[model samples]
Target: MDIKTAAALHRLRLASIPEALSFPALLIFGTGFRIAFDYDALVMPLGMLHGVLFVIYVVLLLDVWNRTKWPVKRVAFFFLLAILPFGGLYGDKVLKREEAAGVAAAQAREEGTVDA
Candidate 1:
């Protein structure tokens, strides 16, 4: 892969970190809110918010996976994280570390200090 692809992967990975955190939090809050109160006024809006966040999260996840060619296990792990309660926090940390490494490597490659 070229620097362009590597750079893109860096960007995608960085962008995904926040979504990894926010999406699951929203899911949990919405689910809990619905169960605890069942208020149509709040639940309805929560559902809509969840739907939008879910779509964005999935799109970002798939795009990062496809663009970076992450392995099945890694992708599957992230998919799992999307569901498990509080998983996004861990996922956020993991992605942050990954982003650091990937960005560093991408920079190195661009500088001809690492193999392309």
Candidate 2:
């Protein structure tokens, strides 16, 4: 992919990761807090936020996949990562590395310094 495309995809990928992570974590916390504290206040707002963020994450994921044309394996892993705790951070690292490599290749082509 070109650097611009890669960069844009990377931003979308990175932005989505946090929303994905937060939704689950907050859901767990909100559920637990509602049970433990017996406060109705904690449950409703967090539930709403989680639902909204979840939708945003899905939309952002689709956008990145469409733009990046990532292999199925990579895309699947990325989606899986969103659900598992700490997965978003790990996925971000992977995406960053991929983005950096793509950017480097584009730079090399521009400089007439391609290895091949």
Candidate 3:
């Protein structure tokens, strides 16, 4: 990938991590707080927050997928991960690994030691 596309994908990937994490966390907290405290006031605000984060996550996911041209399986994996509690941690790890690999490959090309 070109530098611009790669950079954009990286940015999207990074952005997705926090949104993915926050969505589920807010949902869990909202539910727990409602049940434990019998207070529903927090639900609407929390739900709105989660909804916005989820939309951001989906948009970023699509942007990254388009830029990276990842396999459908991988794209689906990320889509599914966004809905699961704590799945963002896993997604972050995967993104980091991919970024490292891309950097290493770029360095290797620069050094005339390309691997196949």
TM-score against truth, every candidate: 0.70, 0.78, 0.78
**Candidate 3 on 1-115: residue-level lDDT in tens?**
5455556557756766777777667778888999999999998998898778778878888887887899999989988887786786788788877877777777777677875
Q: Give the candidates in order of lDDT, highest first.
A: 3, 2, 1
lDDT at position 92, candidate 2? 77
| Prediction 3 global C-alpha lDDT | 0.77
| Higher-scoring candidate on TM-score, 1 or 3 | 3
Error of 1 at 19 (Å): 5.5
RMSD of each: 3.3, 2.5, 2.7
Worst lDDT window (10 residues) for model 3? 1-10
Clashes of each: 0, 0, 0
Once model 1 is optimally superposed onto the true structure by TM-score, how far is the C-alpha of residue 44 displaced, in angstroms? Answer: 1.2
List candidate 3 segments past 4 Å from native.
Answer: 107-116
Tens-digit lDDT string for candidate 1 (5-97): 555545545544555555456656767877889844665675576566556666777877877798989988877776655565577677667
